[model samples]
Target chain A: MSNKSLIVTLLATTLLSGPAFAEDVTLTIESWRNDDLTLWQDKIIPAFEASHPGIKVKFTPSAPAEYNAVLNSKLDAGSAGDLITCRPFDASLALYDAGHLADVSGLENMSNFSDVAKSAWQTDDGSATFCVPMASVIHGFIYNKEAFEEVGVEVPQTETEFFAALDKFKEDGSYIPLAMGTNDQWEAATMGYNNIGPNYWKGEEGRLALIKGEQKLTDDQWVAPYRTLAKWSDYLGDGYEAQTYPDSQNLFTLGRAAIYPAGSWEITGFNAQADFEMGAFKPPVQNEGDTCYISDHTDIAIGLNAKSENADAAKTFLNWVGSEEFATIYANALPGFFSLSSFDVAMEDPLAQEFVSWRGECESTIRSTYQILSRGTPNLENETWGASVAAIKGTKSAEDLGKELQDGLASWYEPQQ
Target chain B: MKSPRIKSHVIVFLAPAVLVYTAIMIFPLFNTLRLALYTEADQVRMFVGLENFRTLFGDPRWSESFWNALANNFWFFVIHMLVQNPIGIALAAILSHPRLRFAAFYRSAIFVPTILSFVIVGFAWKLILSPIWGIAPDLLSAVGLKSLFAPWLGKEEYALTTLALISVWQFVGIPMMLIYAALLSIPEEVLEAGEVDGITGMAAFWKIKLPLILPSIGIISILTFVGNFNAFDLIYTAQGALAGPDFSTDILGTFMYRTFFGFQLQLGDPHMGSAIATAMFGIILVGVCIYLFGIQTRLKRYQF
Candidate 1:
């Protein structure tokens, strides 16, 4: 008799809650940018909600390094959020091919992004666009202004000058010359190799050529960067082999390190932690007259979950994500992340301004291994990470590392073969 | 009719436990083993039948990483066997002394790390050992031994060993406690007998206490083997998924995790992951079986 009453009570409660829940559509976003949680909740989501009263949005994020694993598991279990944050290149491309992410070509203001901006999320044949281009991070060095004065060095423009300044810092005895570590291996590659690489590769020309199999990694353009990276360890203070990403950041921000090999993404973070004034400089050119090329890598984008129940509301949210207003908000909220859109944003932060200003001064290219080249076994990105660390540590010669990368690529990547 | 009546009670009582076990343990174990035998081919899940194992063992890329992980895993285990166990046994011996004062304080202090989360232990040690801002350099410098310090966690040469020691520091308490309890449970009359025979202190421990606690020590050894093989969190927290300083610390668990779950830009292949898991299972099974069928039978278990 009590069982029947319990069943009736459950039915009644379900009926009551169902209608109330339906009154407002809540869309959850999966992202790896945990640092931007408060910014999203306070500004981005509230702004979106204010425009669309019936739709509510929640921004959920996991650790940056664990994001790929977390998102894949969640998607496999059918518990993914309505909106999915997208990594650049083959990683997100896999999700799109798997039908986990929906096409967003029909999204409002989709045309606002350039061909280059949408290049990361588009199908190989350039038929379908799956994610809205959000932001790109430029690679450079973030230096302490005070440290520069103490070391008696001006901002370096040439590779020779860069090394000279590093030598000066070393002689000064108070500061670490270059602040970067191989502990978290990606920082060693992302901030070290990829940052300085384009200066040798000639940016998009070499990257595109490498993709087409016209330029091998063994070529002078590619191997030259590794040769340069081998010298980086000497300036990286003693015991840098064990120093982590956070340690490097702390070293620079605490005014103990003169220059930090950086992605523009570090601006917001460095700004928060640092007390001393900071400045930004692009990767120093090998020659005085050489055209500088920056790694203006498209970092993150957002796409719709194909299996979302609130597809319409999610589409509405995605359309907003493509807009200039969203671009401005996101780019400014995270100063280091410049908008991928053609919309020229006036960044309030000076360090960010310095990074973005390079777009006009230099040719820009994404990381060489990020695109289709990394699709196979012995992933090129992973290979580059180890290779970079080895280069810095001088455990492997540049020639050997180049051959290893090529060999690994040839083992799987057909174009390289 | 009476037999049927008796069987019904057994079936009813056994049903819940049997069902739960099958769902959680038995099913997953079989499924993982089954998955090791299959793989995705042309977007279709098909029976590859030893293909994954062939690739794992024969292919240079797969085999190199596999062998490396296996070797590192052995080293990780050897460190525990050589260092952690001996330290634990020594601590247990010292603490078991009847004349020892503040034994409770020492026991609690030593055992505290064992109860702490792997994440806390990993990060805490990482911080303590950090060269940039860590206290380790400061502490060493204070003693004029600053030159003796190197970035232990960052160097490829020392990363695995340093991590092993940190792990030993965290988990030494487990074996210590087990051996302590085993030592305490030995009848006081036995010690009294040893006292009358000139077997006191070290001699008494070697002759009386050590032999009786051999079973417990055996159990602790097996437990350490299993725990070390299964370790992922501490390494993941301290080093990261790639187990860096150039994958120097990659063990079976991390390798399996990286293969199965993927990390960074590398895509996960569950079939390959399952194959690695199966390999790990085989290794562990061999260890456990040796302990159970060979070692355990030789060790004498005593009763009061």
Candidate 2:
């Protein structure tokens, strides 16, 4: 080959490689629901790329349960993504404490959100901020409105009426009163134990007592929820343990279950069904004196991994999530209750608007239970609460369950110092 | 003396496999074992001797779960022993039938599930058995056994069994193929000779074929035992580490995972997790030793 031809080819190759140097940043953002939220990646991310010009955002998703596992492994290896999604509660406090999370303390638009949301988003007792709440979710019983109407039951306002309505549905043979999936243990704990039990336990006080080790999980006060759950189990379809979240959801949507106790995250999935017009309501207390409690967790949040190679780009992305542009897209496409401070996205879905209005009353009395119960309580669910489910099923007695939970949690709570 | 070239030749021939094995297997194995002898406080690891083991076996919090999972793991192993190997053996024997049509198709069809990722299988099974969907009920009703249709996966009484059956369904083909290879290795002259001696059909299978294939069956059983004891993928994919419906399906592998990586309530403790891993390794080692020395020794093979 001639030297001139070779020099020309090399020059062309170097010019092509120059753009690669300019577009040097690849920010990996990992979440559990990239497939579920395909719109965000296809539309919103491209919009960001068009505006930003030189940065590329690679969306990495892991399987639901394995997401956290993979994330933790990455963190341990010091190779975590630039942006990560986490549900910020008591469980996530350890990640914050370990210095694995970047503090997005002074990010713009932090002042606009509610104090409760900001507090919820913070990791180090509100001093350090780790994540920005991408979406807020509320947990309540989502009833099939048509199913309830067929059974001549109104939304139960009190605990007595709730149980009566459930019984009435059971008597009519129209549908199972409550369709619960236990394939995920946390489902039971979320709907059965954390939601209703806390209401019966006198709300936040009861949770605090458990957290402080002042109240034993075996105490007689705890028996009511177990008995209530045992009764609730009678209405669950046979082979319910094998049933997963989506399966149980199909029960409610298909008109097999009158009441499906789940979170508002299920609303979109429910709305897609042709068989039912879904409605959301809080579970009624067994007694009039009992305050209604709603169980909840942040559906998703954006946090910067402390080990990110590109912290500036990660910060910019997080800032956009909290910005009005991102929130508008999220609210319009996703239809979740956006927790941001200043967004003029009109309340589009009538059903979702009703939930938003009701959420005001719900959050007023809303208290966190699982956080206190879960924090520092090792094997408490598996050995105690899980055994309780089996015990209530007549595999073991209630007394045996009480003893098992009491003994298991004693070591967990006993002074380690 | 042997030539100096002989020593160099041996090293050259064996070097690649030995180096690869040492890097991948021996190093990680020892590292995991070494990690078991440490404790973590505020993210810093400290040497803790056997305290982690003591905590695993002695502390009420860890001991009960550890023991329960160990028991469940044994039951899981038992199910494989009772179901997988026998079905595999039967299918292998039948497929080894030279008269059978489309043997390759049957073999391939049955073996398809073994290639599926446990995540896919777990979700697929979860959807198929969901009572709300009514597919399971429809199938059962068609079989004239609709009354037997119940939520099998959700009930604590039946969760483990259902999961075991699902696992066995997926894995039976492995043993089937292994034993099929072994059965084909047996010469046609022995079977023809058996037929000539008036030992034919079921009798020939029982008297002559079964004895020769005993070693293959033994190997399959040992493999099943080891696989079942180490089983985690399906349960983890389906139920998470907590193995819910109140931990009814908690097995040793899941328990080990929960210990290693903290879930909603528990903090991750690598020391305890490593100890559990060590315990699992020991159990598997003991089982392998027993199979090697005991079952393998008793199963005599006469070359045909």
Candidate 3:
């Protein structure tokens, strides 16, 4: 055929297929993950388009820190993406209350999600489901098996042994005992300090005390953890404060630090490195009396925009994300500990298996620091904690630090209480 | 007395821009301020008058945060004023020098960071400063100053100041270009006359060039004031919403975000957020006013 005739024929075919061929509607999925995950979107969306025959998915990524800022800005400006990853906190609740997120209860496959995940997505006002759960990222301390082995230390299971192992590692001078980079303030809690703090200082009883307001943040018990953190700080290489979040992780990966107190989401990135024998442990407890706690941070849990024009498409997407096929897809692409109750998909990473085991064995739940510290305390309390960490380390009395926290909490809790 | 056709044309010409500005900027800004006066209860909003503002400034929990961020925000602005604008002026003066080579390349290189998305700048800097991953230590080691490399972004004492300097580094090009353009616009004869009268080099810059660019400098200062107060993305991206190493880098923007969006446990209060926004707006307005009434009028425009 002549070039003109062939071009005309192709145009006619495209016209005949119309929106139905390309998945007529283009929907944007907003997430805070790195743009490197565009591969997932580019591949998955095409498959969905081909199978469903009418939906083109566009991925709109935001910086993880600025995710909320961007989401708020977009929602405020009334130009938010159709689908967005939502968190289980007041921030998400606020967005829901603002009438920015659409009610997604009527999605056909809502029943596939676990009860906890479902409740997490529900608005605080007992309103309709406004979001869908994606990957359930849980946080804990992960260590390099090779580094631990090289240093002749076994992964400490109990809290007492955890510190002992670190001490041993320190004595041997083979590895930096703990690979924690506290430069990122949130890691002090999320990956290490906060997750392990409640387990060690408060335990389940302490956690209960905190919830009931029987204990302020500066209780005498908090001293132990603060001291422990200070001890850990000594093992950190000189000029550790210069490290960023990714830097700290890289240290662990590069075997500069023996252990990284971080979340399970990091396993994929860590495992990708060659010759790393990595195992994750819930922040170790000092005694069996204490709870072996692992803080949960479900990564990229998705929800519908309350004002989404493509509510039906969003519903379909949410249900698909919760489906077994979706589970398999996620497992194949980005394998980690997800919060799906469906027994269909298996975990790929061994660290995830360890996380799953600890999660399964958990007897009680203490809300993570991100939840408590964020929810109970007003903003910038963490900032105060960062300064206070140094203060306490600098021969400042634990009592004084505790009192400061007590005073601080009193200021925050008094008004809200 | 205006003709109907002229009036219609004027309205038509301005309608789109005005509508968009109001809808996107002015209306939301006012709405945010209004939201500050209301509190959320069981997902429903309650009108609380000045309660939110009161909580923000008076309640210990809110007040501590507000004051810290406020103080930090002021410091952030002061740094920009002291470092960014002056440096920009200096660079602009140098770059605008007669027969300077590679001026375009230097200008472009300096402005590159400003055009980059906040994520790139935040992470890139974070990487550069990372003792574990960054080459800063390696580069420093080459110069025998590796001991100087510390995670500036992670330390409570250094985080804010470090980030401020980073911001100044990225944004200096803006004021530089602005002052440069303004400097170029000054009449050459005036400069020549100044030269003839014995004012030259540093004297010419300080006595002659500096006075002429006062209005532009004033504009840059106010812009800095407003921008610094409203700043979020850089700190948020580099520091996270928690603004940690224990919130050392917490500024008004991050504080406002945590309050408005509820990070973990604390419920987000829109009223409080709105109150914060209103406070920011008030602060910015006061700053602009001070510049307009107190400073700008005294800084003679030097039309010549």
| Each prediction's whole-model lDDT (CA) | 0.91, 0.75, 0.73
Q: Tens-digit lDDT track for model 3 on A1-417?
A: 699999999999889878565556667888877643655566667656676656678887877655776677888787988888887655676677677777777777777776556656676545677776666666677887887778788777776688788888789886877766556555654554556665655455665566467766666566566666666676676566655566677678887778887776776777776366777777777776555655555444678887788877777777777677667666556656465545456766677777767766663343434334444553334534463455424445555666666665555564324
Model 1 lDDT per residue over B186-271, tens place:
99998998898888978988999999999998999999999988888889999989998888999999999999988788988999
Q: lDDT of model 1 at residue A129?
A: 97
Residue-level lDDT for A276 in candidate 3: 65
Number of the candidate with higher lDDT, 2 or 3: 2
**How much does each candidate deviate from the true structure in C-alpha RMSD?**
4.0, 4.1, 5.4
- Better candidate number, 1 or 3, judged by DockQ: 1
Clash number for every model? 1, 11, 30
Question: Higher-TM-score candidate among 2 and 3?
Answer: 2
Give the candidate number with the greatest DockQ: 1
Instruction: Please identify which of the two predictions, 1 or 2, would achieve the higher lDDT against the true structure.
Output: 1
Residues A45-125, candidate 2: write the lDDT tens digits: 887888776678888888766676677888888877888887556545667778878788789866656655665557535
Can you rank all candidates by DockQ, best first?
1, 2, 3
